[model samples]
Target chain A: MKTKFTRPERRLLAASCAVPITAALCTNAGAMHIMEGFLPQGHAIAWGAVCLPFVVWGLIAMRKIVAQHRKAVLLLAMMGAYAFVLSALKRPSVTGSSSHPTGTGLGAVLFGPAPMAVLGMIVLLFQAILLAHGGLTTLGANTFSMAIAGPFVSFGVYRLCRKLKVNRLVSVGIACALGDLFTYCITAAQLALAHPGEQGVLASMAEFLGVFALTQIPLAIVEGILSAIVLMMLESFAKPELREIGFLQKEVVKA
Target chain B: MSKKQVVTILILVLLCAAILIFPLMTIRDSEFGGADGQAEEVIAQIDPDYTPWAENILEPPGGETESLLFCLQTALGAIVIGFGFGYLVARKKYRAEEAV
Candidate 1:
């Protein structure tokens, strides 16, 4: 088999390979977002039901992207892998919550939040079934928090930053960081609702948020920076593909 | 380096430093845990009678082995997905060129 890759393509491949290895080295073993069977059956079912519509919409959006731009098929898959690897790289934080980059921000920015719905769900499923990181029953709750909520925040923040005419890389960083923080907030809310203290759901939510903030804030900043770096690499090496996927405007690519 | 490159580097360094320093300064002895475990603990504290409605289908033998399996799974998934996407994209690019 004669496979000739362009210089940029080769570099992209090398970078992609290096990312997971380095991330693995940096990771620590810890519990993730919501463990298996953590949520009550009603909450889990309700959350899963909530995610169904988004997942369906995501499937439609992904299909359209694939049909319109054949080149994007691979990028979508790579985005899924990137999210998996990044989320798995857990850094111990001052708070009990082990911290890691959500990695949804980049995908949401590149592919839009809809496609991320599908990608995130798949990643969660793999984590649950293969690594035992999450549980099948709690899949819905995890998916709702990490996949659905995180991506939407990321996409929204990116759009908002662009509207404000922020620096592209800085915008990406902020969006990713905000998205990470938002995911934890939602997770806290979910946990509080499921198991409200004597003080009530509002009080419990506040407690969870406070506990998470000690770790999540710094983690979010790290995630934002990492996502910006990844985006910069893509802009440099995968400009053509980014243009094809409509992530980079033609004028910007030309410049 | 370009201004953008310099800014990017600076941000990365500052964030890395903050992540490392904050933990050392505030809570040097805190046992880092996952949100899930912490949530579970809080739930227990809040309502001792609360019982989990579900259980994991399988539990890993130990924490070290569990981490090993997770690392393996993630690495394998990354390679397969990455290669598959790369192949598809390369094929599309090649086919387009061949037609032209």
Candidate 2:
């Protein structure tokens, strides 16, 4: 860290963080991706099949990162833990609408979308089995939306912003926010397809979108800002690790 | 933490508070519910006959148990990130001293 925190300062930081976390605990676990056994059998199987290739790719990518970068092992663990923390912290928003942040965006930005596939799959698996939240049957569909779709969006936004030479934090924030928004969009689409409304699939999608997208906008921004703060912390204390991981090239992050 | 980072973090805390509280203030008679359930409601609206056939092999006993498991997930996550960060910071600090 650039500065060592005093006892009081640490307390203040913890107190500030405690507010949202405590609120999260009080809220119902409602905003998780398509719940247990929600999808029809064929749709469920299809979604799972679709996610198979990505999960395999992610396993390979993660193994490569672990085998190649001993120093970066800690970074990898931090990223996984970060995804666990954020997804578990569901935020309630406007008009009693509640949703959760997919912390995968930060990992996608730091590493790449590929490794996030494995981490996200594991998180969803645990949520399904232990919490009885998002179901095992719908795992494939949920994984596709939260893991593959979200991370890809984040990685794309991040790469685009970096290519444009935008400020580092801005890149991280925009990428993560958009990535978070996209996850729900896919979820809405998945639900729409499974149960098309009277008007049609498009109408059904719009209905699902209406429920999720509006509330997600602000939550997405919140995820973005929080992610940028984490990146800032990493840069301060884990400069060597970041550099070794090729996240901070000689002038890439320099203002 | 550095002054800039601390300030940024505090701003985040305040912003999150606003996001959570604004709805309660503006919208009345709102049942703050989960989006997943809302989506399911939409599904029911579309296909009234359809019922979710698959079941969780191990359902958490109740909402409380579910909450407990969620909290456990959070705790495990916190510990991993905390230990990873502490180790990295300590390695940097002590390694700097050794180089000096």
Per-prediction tally of clashes: 1, 0
CAPRI tier for the interface of model 1: acceptable
DockQ of each: 0.32, 0.53
- lDDT string for model 1 (A1-255, tens) is 012345664565455445334443322111127777677766676677666656666766776777777877767777887788778877767664576667787889888887887888877777777667777877777777788898899989987888787888888989988988898898889888988868899999988887666678878888888778767756654665777877787336534
TM-score (C-alpha, index-matched) for candidate 2: 0.87
* TM-score for each of the candidates: 0.80, 0.87
Q: State the lDDT of candidate 2 residue by residue for B45-77, as single tens digits.
A: 987888888777798778888889889999999
Best by lDDT: 2
Give lDDT: candidate 2, residue A53. Answer: 57
| Candidate 1 error regions (>4 Å) | A1-32, A250-255, B1-18, B21-27, B77-100
Best model per TM-score:
2
